[model samples]
Target chain A: MSTEVEIKSFIVRNFAPDVPPDQLEPDLNLLDSGVVDSLGLLRLIAWVGERFDIAVEEADISPDNFRSVDAIAAFVADARRNSEVAR
Target chain B: MRWNDDQQALHDAITELGDLLSENRAERDAAAVFPRANWDRVRATGLLGLPFPDRWGGLDQDLLTTMYVLEGLGHSCRDSGLSFSVSTHMVSVGVPLLRFGSAALKERYLPKVCDGSAIGAHAITEPDNGSDIMGMRTTAVRDGDEYVLTGGKTFVSNAPVADLFVVYARTGKAGSPNAITAFLVERDTPGLSVGTPIGKMGLRTSPFSEVSLDGCRVPATNRIGGEGAGFLVLDHVMKWEILCSFIINVGEMQHRLERCVEYATTREQFGQPIGSYQSVSNRIVDMKIAVETSRKWLYDTADKLQRGENVTTDIAIAKLTASEGNVSSALAAVQIFGGYGYTTEYGIEQGLRDAVGGTIYSGTSDVQRQRIARMLGI
Candidate 1:
């Protein structure tokens, strides 16, 4: 699976376990749909950082990236590819 | 009595210190310092013994007073670990001795505890026992003039620096829940050893560790009550411990809620503050509801406890509501603050970690549900 699909799967499994794979669109709003809360978001951040081997900084954890699964995946991809530059 | 003039003074004093403490929390948390100065500052404020007897230099206050002062401390103080340590000291150690200690034990320990000359801890959770108190493996064999204790207690709060500990061990019957006995074991006694503090995910500032008693001998007079009374003593004190923890979290909920509101009103997005969006605004409103309801429940529980009313159900309900609601409030606060909330610089991240431990300590949320279910005859 693509990195985006993998990240999406992880988020869905944790925050929206019942979410069907077909419905796991890239741009689906996780927070808005009540899939996760703040603590869940923290856990997600740690998971993304560990899996992608990126240093997701405090400033990077915003609605811009985490508002939707697509944004989060894209942000993670960018951070992973340019992990050194982001840090 | 409710928080009278003296209690108000104590509350105000701690709140002032809290303001200073919260500002310095990031540094203290990083360093893992025990916050001795802040603790002494609280001692000077005379709130250290708010719930103890007046004769022992305590405030002789009720649970309401204790809750108010502790709440104010939780709001003003930045170090939740330190506040937790103090709460554990008062509820788990001081209260137990006050309620069950022999007059001599009280005269010797209560004054020292009230004066902050000594820190006290309760050691009960063994490596083999977490939720199952009956699974404790510590044994205390009665020798000629003393009980020889042999076993290790894990997750002991304040074990490192405590001068006195209310240690529990099997004294009457093995594997029997009612066969345990509580003893006041002084530090430096032969065979009493404290392990290095356990490095934990949060509450790092409050030092915790294991205490092992290998042939640790203590006079028979140090026992809290008759043989096999330890479980009963723990039962009486755990309710208070649970309640005190809820009160502290209530303060944290208020603190986080206020910070989220302040951040929402300031930070702009798409030509308007992010909080202007219904999603953000509604979450903040939910937080307010949670905070208010949790506080009201805590207050009612405290009042009932102060009035000597049966508060088993009330205490359980309050802990469940406050802990779950505090998590909600912290989550909303972080969301409202966006990226800043997730960073260590903003302290919101730390608050979340500190708050997560609440769901585990005192008693886990799962255990609270079971207690409530059992209470309801489910």
Candidate 2:
């Protein structure tokens, strides 16, 4: 599987292990859907940043980027790719 | 900046154990058992030995792991009494020995404590000196090869089943700042007697009793540290005890707040869920705010402790915040549960009773306020 899919699995397992990976879509609302909430979202972001060695900017952290597992995975991948370019 | 893989694994382990503990909470609370079976599981999981050296059959885990494990236990178990018992021994008794005990003492007792073959207690409170340590009247007179101890301690947790006690007694003139000394007293000593367990308003599952030392004789070898060192030992443990208790309160508040949210969203009133009403929803929101803020403070304090930073002021405020937040959250839970909250059948009232003890024990809410006031230079 792609790195995003792998990252998505990690985030979902940390908070909501019952959520199937196949059900994760890029546009889905994790909080509104009761998959994770504000505190859980921050925890997920921390997990992503640590696992992938990328720093997430506070300004860039919002529901738009973290509303779904797929979105979160993509965001993490983009951050990693961008940091690699900067280096 | 972020948790490592080992940290993540430990966190997951604690969360899983917490869920398991939560499942047995009701039965444990109802029966008020000593939780020997649960403790056995803890021993098998190596939690009983978490802080000791790995050479001595311990996990030797960091303080962070200890904090998380206890908090997870508090979150899921809902048995404040049992958690209180475990912590009193682990911090109040186990830590002092590990940190200050002579090599001989460590060799003799550390393994037993680590294996859960023995439980421990610390005696500091006296009939006249609940919060005032200097006012304690317990005395230990030095003899040729032994010290004869004569004093009484009340409200001691784990007294009924404790195999050892790290007891404090006056060894010098009354009111002397360095008059007090600490001793490691065994349970079956001639003059040492355990009183009938006191019936408490909350945390009843943990055995608490008055300890009477009438001419109790302890060998000089049993003494911990030197003359007048008891006060220092007491001071060191208080910060740890207060913080650990606050961690428990944070966990319980989280559980109760989550319960309120679930109940509010599902239970109906007037053809719709009661949560739609501002009255009910507002209380839930308040609970969330308290839980969230207290949790933040809890983590901040834990982090500060992990770094060995100066946190006297931070810890006092955190204790006060957590105690008050727990009381309010438990009360809110009762209201949300309605009549069910009042009865033991629901466990809400029990949580309130258990939470009330937090305000009184570990230096009462009044003491916490005074500390904060002093820190403010008022």
Candidate 3:
């Protein structure tokens, strides 16, 4: 599955179960819309870091990066690319 | 879990210091005075440096070791307010700086923090926002090399005497966690004002107050982590604060239980000792249960956190259990002590007062339940 699709699946399964896959839009504002509260966001970031094999530094934890599934996937891609460059 | 010889020695030393440091606590509590002498004692015992790196003038103790010593402090120290201040000073500014601060920031500030020469506090809860940390009205605007901070914070513990304040202010979109940012502001900075201590029902000796910043300018270098990482830093700090603070409460509850057990065995009513009465004995038994359960939840949660596991639900449960358990144990102690507990001279009443703040601070018992509910996807 695509990274974004996997992320969306994870969010739906863990955070927003009642919202159907199609209804939970890729660009939905998870934080502001209350789909992801503080604890939910922390869990999501941990999942993203582990799943993507990237270290989500405290500095990298921002709402803009985790605003939606697409944003999280983008962040993961960038982090993976950065780590690859470092390697 | 077994503590090493060094950890046991540290615990015993802190217990010894507690006897000397907490001697005048009742008088200080009566006067609502902040204990500078007690802070000095903490410094002398090297406990102020317990959880920091050894290179930074610390003993480089682990989380569990630090918790163990702090639990000893709670048990041996009669001054709960003083104990609260010590934990606040350690975890509030120190935890964030160690986690998110730049190297330069650490080099300059951490030594003083470790030595207890600098009293540290965090200003986050504002008049408008208590549990809703994201809704703070404080704003920080970047102006060249400095950030201009403007806002007021309330219920700031150690504010009246703190040397450094880790101030949280809005920097990005409202209601978003990333919208907030953390800034390390010095007490000597211009436009920063600390109001006199606000009288509280409990922890009066701790001396919480209002901190107002009117366009206070702080160096950009003073910001911990990035421009919008205040909530993340606070999230980390709160976990440590809750763990350390409630573990101290666990120690206090254990002490209370011990005292109650002693009183039950000695104090007589009717023909036999009060221990003969099921009502009083049952209450003491409940106190024991509360203390043991709180200790279990605390250590188990801390262990999970150390393993890089998600402890959101576990921490909430632990915090709730420890905090509410403290209050229950304190109340039970008072009843077991009978009239002596009610009197200020015996100082059993202070236990109830000190335990009350544990439920309110570090997010209220209600907020903790809300967190658990959220974790359960409710």
Q: Weakest 10 consecutive residues, lDDT, candidate 1 chain B?
A: B171-180
CA shift at B69, candidate 1, in angstroms? 0.9
How much DockQ does model 2 earn? 0.01
Who wins the lDDT comparison? 3
Give the distance in Å from residue B111's predicted Cα in candidate 1 to where it truly belongs: 0.4
Give the higher-lDDT candidate: 1 or 3.
3
| lDDT, candidate 2, B66-167, per-residue tens | 766667667776667777877787776667777657788888888877887788888888888997776789999999889999989999888887889989
Model 1, C-alpha of B267: deviation from truth (Å): 1.0
Q: Give the TM-scores of the predictions, in the order they appear.
A: 0.78, 0.77, 0.93
Task: Give the per-residue Cα lDDT of candidate 3 at A46.
Answer: 67
**What's model 3's overall lDDT?**
0.87
Query: Highest DockQ: which candidate?
Result: 3
Q: What RMSD does each model have against the real structure?
A: 20.5, 19.0, 2.5
lDDT for each residue of candidate 3 in B1-378, tens digit (9 for 90 to 100): 789999999999999877787787788998999888788988898998899998788889888899999999999998888899999999988889998899998998889899989999999999989999988899999999999999999999999999999999999778876778899999999999999999987776789999999989999999997887788888888999999989999998998888888888988889789988999999989999999999999998888777666676788899999999989988888888888999988778999998998898999999999887766666
Sorted by lDDT, highest first, which candidate order results? 3, 1, 2
